[model samples]
Target: SRSLLKLLEAKALIELSNQTKPPQGWPSSPARNLEIPPNLNPDQANVLQLFQNQREQKEWLLWGVTGSGKTEIYLRCCIPELEAGRSVLMLTPEIGLIPQLLERCQRRFGNAVVPYHSALSEGERLATWRYCRSGSPCVVVGTRSAIFLPLPKLGLIVLDEEHDSSYKQEAPMPCYHTRDVARLRQQQEGCGILLGSATPCLETWLACQKPNNSIGLLHLPQRIAARPLPPVRVVDMRQELADGNRQLLSRPLLERLSGLAKRKQQAVVLVPRRGYSTFLSCRSCGQAVTCPHCDVSLTVHRNSDGHSWLRCHWCDHRDEIATNCGQCGSTAFKPFGAGTQKVLEQLELELEGIRLLRFDRDSTRGRDGHKQLLERFAAGEADVLVGTQMLAKGMDLPKVTLAAVLAADGLLHRPDLRAAEQSLQLLLQLAGRAGRGEQPGEVLVQTYDPDHRVIQHLIAGSYAEFLEEEAAVRRIARLAPYSRACLLRFAGPQASLTASAAATLLNHVANQLREADWLAIGPAPAPRARVAGLSRWQLLLQGPPASPIPLPSEQILRRLLPKGVHLAIDPDPMEL
Candidate 1:
């Protein structure tokens, strides 16, 4: 408060005004000002040149490879607007990015950074909001929700990891895309929107080419150190198992990982999901135990003392393990697939005397916990780290000489158009984790389809070519920036009511925007149709180039939903 008041004092906006009020004034002067180091690459500087807000309303898309320093590029553009005394709103798709981003912004910009994410305490959020509204907070770094932070002088908006699904709000009003929101806000406030990604979402790349809809294109094709993209070898598990090599880790990867661990170099293990076991299925009847409260499977995890416990993945409910299957009463229940926890157990057996750490939603549940765990890992207290998608986002480990994806096809089968793009992004990011400080990193992807085109493209390090192919597929499918796409989801206790309302809304939407030649799909049951005791129905809408669907997503949802029903709109949904 004192620092803010001092900045205001320097600007002559506020006088001492008696030097004392009952309780509403300065505490002390700014103590020990913080300095922001200039840590941006030369190519990122070139990007700042094109997007200085004096140029045309061109929303430039930057594609930076992993370990190529993309976050540094974002800060480069944000610095100028901040210096100009106008607020900067930098939106990130990942919730975990809040802390690292906020610390960097605060240290660099000093107390000017007001972070707003779900992680903040209620008091912190409210205080931060008040500060932003007063026009004193120069930088507002946050997750997708920060889009609504009151900032009239907001001059620059950046969407980092533009391809990530976290940008699309799953519930509540304004279920809008941060990228789209940033673009609209840029127009509303005359700011520059910089979209940065290692593997640019296919839709954004396609939008860059379309002169009518896009601003311009900026590409950073190489990593800062010009390090060769890691060598990616896709192991065919089918072949391995066929040759009687189904011992969990493939022979090639196991040998490589062993050698790396022996040298005391760090290793990161990427699994498809968290938990020890997602479900206990009876091999005979093929029925898996499920949560009675929600329509999702429960995960099996060991307690701190190492006893079995059945825990719901959706709800936090827990139950004692069942000796027999719930339906068949068969004693043949077994964990069919492996998660990070299960893999960690197996790794412990093979690689003894190696310190291992696990990072996932379960482990990093609180602020101090997250910070302490990261500090320990960064300080080399652990050798092998196993994690879920959280491993791919932040937490760069310089000594990580090897990164192994326990299962590469984990995200490949999702019913989303951007699944391939996301897979490539994860592979690129995970591969980038290795060889950051010159020790030469290695990435091993174990998949059945070793010759898949996505694997081939990822291994070749040709995301541009992959983008072209994915864009063509999208064009044929009539989705995304080629044609605008939005997903409408409805959930309520009464299944029929929710389905009926969503169907009615989509029908109304189709008639209102439907043309003689336009194309759209959905008004159907969503993938993972039920969550947390709610039967969910979805609508997928599209419009042609001549007819753009007016997206009053918030208004439309409010109007159509039953009073008790919940509605959400995901513009440019990563998951369909």
Candidate 2:
């Protein structure tokens, strides 16, 4: 029955195979009339020429700065492939980016452009699948899952914003990275692979530096129309406190908002978290409110009716707010950190008649939520757009003149190997959202630690220098680009049982590694030890540079673990 269903989904079998008179062909639409092309700048033309000159190269990297016409280059490269009766696949990091990209591609290629993502209905996905299998040349603008589409006569694959961690899937079984899959497909189909990014990942950067490497490199250092990069100013929050300003909005940021309103301009405010507050704490005993099913603090969320509750971010558990402290029976409680909701409230109180729209996960839940809110903002209906990291992913808003980060300390203090690199990429991308038009722009970052290396690099607008220093540091530590790592995760209902299972697996792996050049660490509790009533533990295996980590078969691994435990294997994990 399972095999039959698979065949049906793949369009290999019909409803009645015995009495078949051939199925009707799907309807096709004619392509729209092509519009006059925009004249390419010198840099963009040079990059396109490099691509044309190296048509046989399988791998290429397009390293361009923000607003440097990278998409123009992509569109120019697609014309020749489509004209030659071959297909093109353009992959973006987020679904929210699809609408704009789809619009652009359709404007140029008309009916040949197809959009695909997880939000589509089952019928829509099935139709798209059948269309791709029809052997007609077309272009697919989609997210990660679209990589599996059966694109016959595939000619080129483009990955935009390649440094984004969103390209890696971490849940369920068969954890995989889209970049790796693209490489495999390129080898099988003999297609060209182009990776375009403002800030490339360390692995890709290192790959392009090897002697006699096959991957070609291209660069675009200047922004379009000779616009200068926005000047970043770091605001010291400690000094603001010493001067007796107790509001969440720093004085400098407040003044800028007022100025923007007076000039009738737009601004984007980036908050690290989305709820009302980070967590609630008892004023008397200093005990933070926690989730019963998980080992992490519960964030406070407030609805429009002024009702508030506690929610566990990892497990989706909800509970009523506590009136009295569980530890000391105290009645006083306070929120420790501010989020998007709290920032919205503070902005309402400080400035009158200021139009604001929330752009985080909570607000954008409907089918057309992202498109609607973005259209409203772009049409000059909102003065300020408050959001999370979604606002930083290559959104080209021309009217936005001020970009502010409310809490830089939160992004800079993460406990991970690529924390600094990720933080810098995010901040730079956020800054790129501003100063994209005729008017000059400015960025204001609020941080307690003004001297942090991330902030210093952001202020200087020094991407190359930062990458060089970071590479040196990673080399000394023998981390990524220097070595490869694989993570083994274990989970069970009981902490002791999970630990025991992990220990057993660790012993098996240790014995295997005794004869190889590999390092084994763990059988320890994971960062968030418990989630959704399950205790979690992990083991890490590191292999030498450019070497593959040898893992046991799935059957062998399952037999090694206990009955009540679950195991997951992740290679090239985005997070440790």
Strongest candidate by TM-score: 2
Q: Model 2 segments beyond 4 Å from truth? A: 1-31
Task: List the candidates' TM-scores in order.
Answer: 0.87, 0.94
Using lDDT, give the best candidate's number: 2
Give the lDDT of residue 291 in candidate 1. Answer: 85
* lDDT measured at residue 329 in model 1 versus the true structure, 0 to 100: 79
Provide the clash count, candidate 1: 2
In the range 53-104, model 2's lDDT, one tens digit per residue, is 9777789899988889888888888888899999999999998888788778
lDDT of each residue in 1-576, candidate 1, tens digit only: 989999999999998553212111112344256665565567767766766643676577767777777777776677677777888888877766666776676666655666677777776677777778888647788888889888978887888878787787655655666777777787788877778778777767777777585657776766666776678878889999999987778888767767665686888889987888868788879998888777778888864467877788776778887888878778887876777778878877887666788888888887656666777887888887888887887556788888888777767766667678888888777787887776778888889877777789878988889989887887797666567666777788877888898877766656555553444576677776777778888877766643555555467558867788888766555567
lDDT of 1 at 26: 17
